[model samples]
Target chain A: MATIITKEQQEKEKMVTLVSSDSEKFVVEQKVAEKSHVIKMVMNCCGIESPIPVRRVKGDILKSILEYCEKHSKGEAQEVMEKWDKEYMDKAEKDLVFFHDLMLASHFLHIQELVDLIAVTFAGMLKMKSPEEIRQKFNINNDLTKEQEEHIMTTFGWAFQPI
Target chain B: MEVCGVPPEQDKTKGFSINDNADLLAEILSRLDGRSLGVAACVCRLWSGVCRRDTVWEALCTRHVSGGAATARAVVAALGGYRRLYRLCMGPVLERLPPARRDEAGHVSLSLSLSLSLFSIDCYERLGGRQRSSLLFLRNTVDVS
Candidate 1:
């Protein structure tokens, strides 16, 4: 049996425009842009004729996010995606500032998979790090008082030990 | 339901950190294991606060624990007291600790310091009908010793 491609189905492949915070314009397929829940919801309601402004995400972050969406939308094999995801995070992990901004953008756009990917990568980085190393890596202040720190050390001290 | 354009970007500094947002921080920390979570809590007040939220532990229980939601909630309620509960699923925290200080480990005595822990008994108490008899529970804490 021959399957028919309807006009409505053709609409799925239509292009959408996204404007980054700094006013850089991105032309993407509707399927690619729909990777963002926020964008998909808006396009569904208002139609995607006008370029949607992603007001918070900067151009660099939006570019990478779009790249991720475009890749994911291809319906590639699992190993390929996993490999792509690993390489994607490898680049993102080099700069904490950039990494954090990307996370913020992914969260804001409600892209659950990207958020999970970035988060899991972040967690993996900290998994082997000591408390002092984590503090140094993330530039966190030691806000715990002497007693509180002591208590944490006493209770979870085993976790700090070299396995 | 109609959102063609997102709100204008706010004037914020270039410096962006996940620590400033609890929700964001929780998302990252949620992907970590109980051991890393312990190390994470020791990082700062914000991480500590996020790590201790019942939701984080409940999520941990849900993933690493078995015997259904009630069991997960009970484990969260008991906090880290009932290490035995997750044994079937997560290999038990006890198995990870080097056995050199075997006797000194996991003793949740009815002491004040233990109460100060996020894994304190209040949650178990809050679980009410779960039979938290003080003697049995405390004695059980020493079973490994």
Candidate 2:
């Protein structure tokens, strides 16, 4: 015997469609979509019946962010969540360009936790590296005059000394 | 027209440069420690300018300073800015107390009267329990006479 499916039952499992900048559509559960504050605001004002257009985020980046939101919305145990977040970041860090895009997207979406995580990762890149190493890594030009560099180096000489 | 105070022209670029985004750059730099911050300040003109902002140094000072809010405020007020205050707090004086000042128990006794004179009436009172313990610690190592 086939169980009867009602319209209200289908409505109870309603989904929201999000369109990325490149016109790629992602159909996700409404709760998972609400993980992004930007989408939540859009839903509150414009109803979830229509697809929300995220014009600034690219398809791949939006997909990745949605994955993060889906996992986070589950409310897993603290230790498990931390382990997952670490693994997620580790994978993202493999491609600096993608990681940068993720950071920018998280910032635009008002996802504070992801922004903080990315910032910490960014800071970690410069943590123990010397000025020359940092300059090379970031492709930064040393614009400081000889005297200016020397003054800063000499004043905080301990920082330059081997730890 | 500006997204996060970044010029619209720079926002369309392929690669992200720290120089192109002020808010993101500041957010990343704020997570660095004093030593890392010092090295970052020498990276380039843009970074040097960002690292020199009082807000960055203030965050560093607040994290490193052990005393309460009153002590931090008093120190910052006396030193003029968080950068100067951080340098003084982390300087050689705190790291290596003069060997000549060590008491019989091998504790380096700071002069309580000198420290007390540095604080105003308001800060002195606000220091409360921390001031009392510090005074006791100092008194234990030094002679009053």
Candidate 3:
């Protein structure tokens, strides 16, 4: 299901079509679509006629992800992008489930940059927070017993040691 | 928010999906500070297990490197406890460490890169001293010099 797409196969003006899970099709410029690692492979293989079907991702998520690819394709200034990414992620994080789906979808698409960006963002949110606070953020639960829990705290005390 | 900050316990099975399972929970705890993660561990038995794992703690340590020694020490502690490190991938930055300090008293082994940076005895001792104090393990050691 996964194939490597080398750099040589990509051309600047090629055209491609992406079909969403719902059969909604989005015709994208090959230049913008190449940003997705998966599509790059398809182009590399010269496998035309197959409308790349992204079955797991919904239409809106696909749109946003493509918007990212399109904006990034312009070779925009890094400073401008850093500012945009910050704002982009800030708004994206608000819709937790949507953000999560986008992450999984990005993973499926094998968009390395997108995956790194989203993972780093999620990782950042988790930083310096308490386990409980983290659980609250993710709506997770504590399932271990008090004695079992204490054993861990005692055994791995070094992680808690002040530097 | 409750005093503990746990969402009001609606049901035991409420948020227990594979997506929010123990592994993910552990990942979340790893991002937190030690105190908060400690407090979270105390909230319940399951949380405690995930919080205490060296893998999780090691990740937290990795995240703290830029914060200062506290972060680096935390990572070292976590690494010390790990019987088998799941995955250790260091990028180019860690790749450029100078020669390891191996002195007469301590068999210190450093990459050639460190030899270039040794200006003072203090730096030399600190570089070599760590080897005398502990063993340094590198997956792939390159001679930079």
Candidate 4:
């Protein structure tokens, strides 16, 4: 008797090549790459014949996002996946530029879950920090006029007031 | 001004700044709560503009408010914008209520105001009808205001 492999099983094991904007290539399982809705749509339309070029995402950021997608596609235990996600985000948070790139990539790729995760992480960084602190951390230049600043302060005075 | 000890490295790898990306900035700001959002609005002109958008406040209102998304939408629609609705929902209940006035004839006036009265009743009924435990917080905050 010969062992038989179904078409669905073979499809599950299919490899998709994703070429980053920097020309770095990442070969990942089709299911993992499909976690990105944009890539999924492309694969659906084009049948994943050639390497899909992610024009907007850099090599490093694309690699990190693919890692996230691959892990999430594994259907791991909830607690385990949560721990992994936390660890991944913690690493990303160490470098704001990289984190920002990852966020943009996720947004462009239409990965809703990843986008939400990055948003939550970014918001956490902004939380409890003063405007000056947030501006400095993110290299944001304050363009508000003195009057505008005063208006904001007066309007949301309670938020600025000490408990 | 730095929250973390090490300053964020200058982006030599990526030329683009996340602050310059409106969609990404909006997505991040949308995760913030009312108080945090107020603080964020003071960060920069761009941030202030993003934070002041009705969509940002709408998301915040829908998330924190009781009832379902539809109920939140209805309440927000009833009030002028998300900012006004947020203020009414989150601000002091007393401030939202109609002022008590004694008529010259020695009778307390109880004229039914249109906006606040109708809004409060609609929200109360919708929130109560949902039977969501979270709705209790909203109900507790608003009582025929």
Of the two candidates 2 and 4, the one with more favorable lDDT, higher being better, is 4
TM-score of chain A of each: 0.88, 0.87, 0.81, 0.90
Give the candidate order by descending lDDT. Answer: 4, 2, 1, 3
TM-score of candidate 1 chain B vs. the reference: 0.44
Q: Determine which window of 10 residues in candidate 3 chain A has minimal summed lDDT.
A: A1-10
Tell me the spans in candidate 3 whose CA falls farther than 4 Å from its real position. A1-13, A156-163, B1-145
Number of the candidate with higher DockQ, 1 or 2: 1
lDDT of 4 by residue, A3-28 (tens): 34576656645988999999999999
Q: Candidate 2 at B57: error in angstroms?
A: 2.7
- Per-residue accuracy of model 4 over B1-145 as CA lDDT, tens digit each: 7665443355532465667788789989998867788899898888888987888877765554333456446656664677665554443332334434211112211211222354465566665675343232542444576
| Top candidate when judged by TM-score against the true structure | 4
- Looking at candidate 4, what TM-score does chain B attain? 0.51
Q: On residues A38-155, what C-alpha lDDT tens digit does candidate 1 reach at each position?
A: 9999999989788899999999999999999999999999999999999999998877788899999999999999999998898888886888988766766788999988887775
Question: How much of the true A–B contact set does each candidate keep?
Answer: 0.67, 0.60, 0.27, 0.65
- Highest DockQ: which candidate? 1
Candidate 4 stretches greater than 4 Å from native: A1-13, B1-16, B65-67, B91-145
Model 2, A1-163: lDDT tens digits are: 1334666556655788999999999999888888888889999999888889999999999999999989998999999999999899999987677888898999999888888888988898998898899876666678889998887777566667653
**Chain A TM-score of prediction number 2:** 0.87
How close is chain B to the truth by TM-score, in each candidate?
0.44, 0.48, 0.37, 0.51
